[model samples]
Target chain A: MRQRLMEATVDCLVELGWSGTTTTLVSRRAGVSRGAQLHHFPSKQALVVAAVEHLSDRRRDEMRRSAAHLPEEGRTRGVLEILAAQFVSPVFFAALELWVAARTDAELREAVAPLERRIGRETHAYAVELLGIDESQGDNRQLVQATLDLVRGLGLAASLSDDARRRSAVLDSWAAVLDHELEMP
Target chain B: MRQRLMEATVDCLVELGWSGTTTTLVSRRAGVSRGAQLHHFPSKQALVVAAVEHLSDRRRDEMRRSAAHLPEEGRTRGVLEILAAQFVSPVFFAALELWVAARTDAELREAVAPLERRIGRETHAYAVELLGIDESQGDNRQLVQATLDLVRGLGLAASLSDDARRRSAVLDSWAAVLDHELEMP
Candidate 1:
């Protein structure tokens, strides 16, 4: 029941946005009773924040599982593709809605700030591990960080419109750049 | 009166999220009568959309003027810094609010889509002009686009926290990478 409600909250966020999403709507979509929903989440902010955190954890675990199956050749390009896809997913959109809404809502900001920080640290660490990057070397850490930023921006652009072709081109170009930078002695 | 109202609309957007911003609030902020505010923009969507387009024009012109004053040496780094600053500005935050709002609001999506496309085109053109890149060369165009995406992502990161030091480090690293890439034959 908790998982169902949280999934519905993310769905509301992605389809209805932060403003349009309501607890009643989420309860109906989740097929959970209003009393049950209120029992679990007292407020909309609490519900949505918990939903995003829940989804993010699931997505991270999924990504780690998928990483184990990556093909041997062209691994860098494959990893870039995976990262780019994650940004364009519904969970990312749900999180974006919260991020923008949190900018003005003090309560939401307080709830979201720490979650965002933890997600950032964990994602960066995961990327470093996936690429086998030696951050002690010159600029390696920054380059990996830049790649994440680039994909995020591309994801934002994708949210506005279907720019998959252009996104693919940019990702391919970035993968080449990353491969070369990492190869440096 | 129009300029004042539009500026006030953006102020409301940054200070208030899309759901919180209203035409009444804008009129109060602009010190304009309800009659005058409605005379210019009939609805909140029209008012906010026009406000973003209006401010974007002003910002672009300001950027063009500033470009002329960039120091001769280290021009690439200077240009990167300028680009990064634009993403962190209040105007960008205003635009971001609309972008997220538009994702779920069909009417707003219609209004914001064209303006966003125009801004994307103009910003890309300006970046190319400032960087003096030869697009005929391999991957130069994609590299420029990636740089814009990188800064945008960094801007999003800044929106959450005061990551200025980390942002500066990323920009410096990108400038060096961009310089090396462009130097290739």
Candidate 2:
């Protein structure tokens, strides 16, 4: 029941954005009574906080799973492609909406901030593992972080455009960045 | 008179997003009569469109002027930093409100799309010139476009956060990508 409510919250968020997501709407969408929602989440903030945590946790788990399957001799571009695809997907957009919403609402921020820190640290650590690059010690860490940010920015921009060529352009740029990074002495 | 109104429109947008950028608000903020504003703009959409163009032009001019001051031996990074600083300022936030508002408003989209294309083209061209890279052929043009999109996304993400570290992280990531691109054989 809790899981079902959480799913409903994400659905409502994607369709309605932060302003439109409401307890009544979530209750109806989940097919759960208002009482059940209130039981689990005393307020709308509580519900949203729970939903963000659930979403962030799920995202982290998916990334970990993908990393686990990487080749022993991992290829940077291949790993990036997998991460990029996921980051550009609907699931991540749901998380993005929540993150954006958190900016104005303290409850949501409190719920999401720890997860955000975790994500940054985890991403940094993952780069160390996958690229065999130390994030704390050189200009390489800056490059890795930049590539991740470029991928992130590209993913969001691609989501907004109707142009396939533009989307392709973003990917090509990511590849170029990766190629450039690897060539560094 | 028209120039003052345009400036006021930008000021209102920076302070209040599209939903808050009504003609009445602009008039009040500009210290002009509603009749005067209406005579100039006729409608809120027209006013907003004009405001977007005004802001974009100013930003482009600022970019050009800033870039002009760079030493003849200025690296691409210096040019990009100036460009980045210009676009991430409060004036650019007004431009972004136009973008975010356009997502749900067709009229706004119609008003802003052409301007968006021009900006994209201009930025890409500028990047090529600043980075001393040839983009007339091959995938480099596309990479340039994607890099600009990354800047846009990072700028918006920075606006939504109070974290200077995150902002710097985003910029560092961008610098890293540029570093990679420059090193490409």
Candidate 3:
């Protein structure tokens, strides 16, 4: 029941954002009674935060599963393409919505703060593993981190406008540069 | 009067976010009565939208001035630092608060949509100029754009956690690779 409600919460958040993800709507989407919803999450903040954390975990797993089968040819490009898509996808946008909301909502921010830290740390480890990089090497680690940052920034742009051409251009150039560097060293 | 109100509006946004940025608070901060605030901006939507656009223009001008004097040595790093700073500053945070608020508020989104489009276009052009890159070259343009994307992503991370060390590491790695690439051709 909690899992179902959490999934519904994410769906509501991605489609409706913060304001629209009301308990009523989430209950309806999750097919739970209002009473049941309250029992699981007393406030909207708790519900939304749980949903974001849930989405991140699910996404991390999905990436790991997808990454294992990447094609040998153009592997760098392949990794970048997958990572970029994830960065701009609806779930990431949903998380972005929360991040933005938490900026001004102190209570919500408190709820989200620790979860975000844990998620970020886990994400870095997951990314390092996914990229098959030597995490001990500062340059290698930074390159992967930079790739994530670049993709995230491009994803934010894509959210606002028709920035596909520009986004791809960035990915291509960065991938080329990263490929060259990793190959050299 | 309008300028004062807009400044207060941005202050409220950075500190209080959307839900907390009441017109009354903005008017009080601006040292104007409610009537004057409404006289300048008929509604909260009008007020917040105007403030964000105003901030964008002001920040744009600031970037232009700062960009003109970038040091010759490690020019790319310097440009990226300035830009990354801008992306995480109060004005950017204010704009981010608006972006998140607009996700759930259709009326607010309508007001912000065109302005966001204009701001983004101007930002791209300004970034090109700041980096002293030829606009005609696709590779050069993409590299500049990529830099913006990376910084924006890092800025987003900075907003959430103690990301300074990671952000600089990414910047250093990307700068090295970019320097090598640009120098080669």
Candidate 4:
């Protein structure tokens, strides 16, 4: 029931955005009673925040599963593709709605900031692991960070429109650049 | 009065997000009468849509003015910094609020979609001009697009927290990467 409600909350966020998403809508979508929903999440903030955290965990798991199957040849491009896809997913959009809402809502900000930091740290670590880059070397850490930022920005553009063709080109170019930069001794 | 109202609308969007920003608040912030506010914008949608277009024009002009003073040496880094700064500005935040809002609001999406496409095109052109990149060359266009995406992503990270130090490092690394990539062939 908790999982269903959280998934529903994410769906509501993606479909209706932060402003239009409400507990009633979420409850109806989850097919959970209002009483049960309130018992689990007393406020909209609580519900949405929990939903994002849950979704992030799920997304990370998905990434890990996908990572295990990356092609031995052209693995860097494969990893870039995976990272780019993550940014365009419904989960990214749902979290984005909350991030924008949390900007002005202080209480929401308080709840979201730590979770975001944790997510960032984990994502960065994961990217580093996937790329097989030694961050202790010069600029590897910054390069990895830049790659994440690049994909994220591409994801944002995707959010606005279907820029997939251009996004693919950008990723290809970036993957080549990363290959060159990281391969340097 | 129209300019003041538009500016106030942007302020309200940045400080309050989309849902919290009201015509009444904009009028109060602009110190304009309710009658005058409605005379210019009959509805909240009209008001914000106009505000974003107004601010985007204003931001473009500001970018043009800033571009005039770029240093001859290390101009690529200078241009990257300027672009990065634009993404973190209140205008970006204001536009972002609308983008997130428009994702679910079909009416606002109809209004915002074209405006965003135009802005994206103009920004891309400006970056190409600033970097003096000949897009006729292989991968140049995609690289420029990636640069914009990278800064925008960095800007998004900045919105969540003061990631300036890490952002600077990422920008530095990207500048070096761009320098190398564009210098090729």
Candidate 5:
């Protein structure tokens, strides 16, 4: 029931944004009574933060799974496609709502800050494992992080419009560049 | 007076986020009456959209000025610094507020879509000019676009925390890589 509510909260954020998401609405979407929601998560911030944290875990898991399944041939492009898919997911949209909302809300920022840090660390670790790169190599690590930033920014742009062709081009260009920079397999 | 109101709107967004930006507050900050504010923008959507477009123009002009005045010998690092500064500016945060709000608000998205498109085009053009890269070179252009994506994504991360040291390192690393890929001047 608690997990169900968290998932529903993320859904509400993706569909209604920060302003439109309410504890009452989340309860309705979760098919639970307001009493049940309050019993588990007393406040809207608590619920939303919980939802974001849950999402981060799920997203991290999904990335790991995708990375594991990527075939050797053209795996770089495969990796880019996986990252691109994450950017377009509802979970990304939900997290974006928190990022924007947290900018001005100190309490929300406090709650979200650690979660983002954890997610960032997990993402980099998995990316290194996925690409078969050595994280101990300083320059390679930096380049890997750069690839992440590029894919994330492209994802943000894609949310506004269909930039698939251009995005893919940029991704392929970046993959070639990364191959030389990190000495990737 | 009109400019003041728009500037105030951007200020409010940076300091207060989207929900807290109201016409009354904008007028108060702009030192104008409510009537004056309405007379200029007529609605909050109009005011926010106009402020974003205005910000885009100013940022482009700043990028141009920075490019023209870049000192030789270490111009590469200087250029990255300028881009980084722009990404962390109040204007970027203000525009980010609109982007998140527009995720669920179709009316706001419709108003912002064209302004965002124009800003994106101008940003790419200035980035090319600033880097002294030949856009006719297909590989060079793709890398330039990728650089923009990297910078924007870094900006997004910096907004969450003070990652100045790491960000500068990434900037330097990417600049060296770009010198190899795009043949930067």
Candidate 6:
């Protein structure tokens, strides 16, 4: 029931933005009574918070699934492709919308902070694994963090633009980030 | 007087979103009489539209100024740096809130379309001049478009994470896009 409610939240988010989302609306969308919603979520804010956690868990699982096929020899390229696909996928747009909505609401921020930390940890860990680099190495760890950030930014840009060629270049450039020779400004 | 009104509109946006923006609020914030606001701009929508235009013009002018100082050899890098800086800057966040508000409102979209087109044109033109690549040329021109989109995404991510190092890598990777060997998998 909680999972169903969380899934319904994404459906509602796609249809109605943060301001438009209400407990009654969500209950109707979920085909559950108002009392049931209150029983499960306690409040509308609580519902959205659970939805955020749901989305984060989904992304983490998806990332791991995609990365499983990466060959050790071409791990860097493979990991980049997996990460790129995960971020740029159409399904993730709802999560992105929720994240954008979180900026204005303190309760949403509280819900999102842990998710962000988990994502950062997973992304950094993936990067270190792909690069075969030690995170304990000073600049190297920073490089991993920085590269993860770059991919996130590039992914967001690719999703928003109408230009296809530009989007492709962003993906390619992202793949190249793992190569040391590509680091020169 | 017009500038003062636009400044007030921006302030109003930072505090209140689309539903909250009104003639009364703008007049109050600007310390101008409703009569005076009517004298300069007849409607709240018109005032908001004009503010959008003002911001677009200001951004274009700033981009030009920043690019003008670039040494010939570093022109491409400098142009992108200026463009990326515009994203990470605090003023841009207020502008961003307005952009999101505009997304769901038809009047706002109609008003802001010209600004979006002009920015695309200017960015493409600057890329052509600075990179010495014709806009009509092959993927070379596409590379420029991609870099611009990437920067926009990077900027959005930076807003949430406050990670400057990641933002810099985004810009750096964009600079490296020219050298990437893109082949469709």
Best by lDDT: 4
Provide backbone clash counts, one per model: 0, 1, 0, 0, 0, 0
| Single-chain TM-score of chain A, each candidate | 0.96, 0.79, 0.90, 0.97, 0.93, 0.79
Q: A86-173, model 2: which lDDT tens digit per residue?
A: 5666555666666655644566677777776676677666765766655565556766666666566666555445564666556655
Residue A34 C-alpha lDDT in model 2: 93
Q: Which 10-residue window in model 6 chain B sums to the lowest lDDT?
A: B176-185
Q: Score the docking of each candidate (DockQ).
A: 0.82, 0.42, 0.68, 0.87, 0.79, 0.28
Note the residue pairs that clash in candidate 2: A146-B173
Please give the interface root mean square deviation for model 5, in Å.
0.9
**Model 2, B32-108: lDDT tens per residue?**
89888899899988887787777777777777787776765435557667766755777677776665456445666
Candidate 1, residue B79: how far the Cα is off, in Å: 0.7
Query: lDDT tens string, model 6, A83-107?
Result: 6565665435555665666655566
Q: Give a tens-digit lDDT track for model 3, residues A37-110.
A: 99889988888888888878888788878888899777888788878888787778888888877876777778
Rate residue B67 of model 4 by lDDT.
90
Q: Give the number of the best model, judged by DockQ.
A: 4
Off by over 4 Å in 3: A183-185, B183-185
Per-residue lDDT for B47-166 in model 6, tens only? Answer: 876876676567767777767778866455566688788777544555566555554456766765666567668766765665656555544554565556556666676656677765
Cα lDDT tens digits, model 5, B1-185, are: 87898789999999998999998899999999998788878999999999888876887787777678798777666777787788888898888888888868889889888888887787788777777777887588888788888888887887778688888889889878877778644
iRMSD values, candidates in order: 0.8, 3.4, 1.7, 0.7, 0.9, 4.4
For model 5, what is the error of residue A107's alpha carbon versus the real structure, in angstroms, after optimal superposition? 0.9
Comparing only chain B with the true structure, the TM-scores of all models are 0.96, 0.85, 0.90, 0.96, 0.94, 0.80
Please compute and give the TM-score of the first chain of candidate 6 against the native first chain. 0.79
User: In candidate 1, what are the lDDT values of residues B1-185, reduced to their tens digit?
Assistant: 89899899889888987888999989998999999888878999999999999999999898989999998788899999889888998899999999988988888899999999999899999998899877768899899889999988988878777689889888888888888787444
Q: Is candidate 1 or candidate 2 better by lDDT?
A: 1
For residue B149, give model 1's deviation from the true position in Å: 1.0
In model 1, state the lDDT of residue B100. 86
How many clashing residue pairs, candidate 1?
0
Weakest 10 consecutive residues of candidate 4 chain B by summed lDDT: B176-185
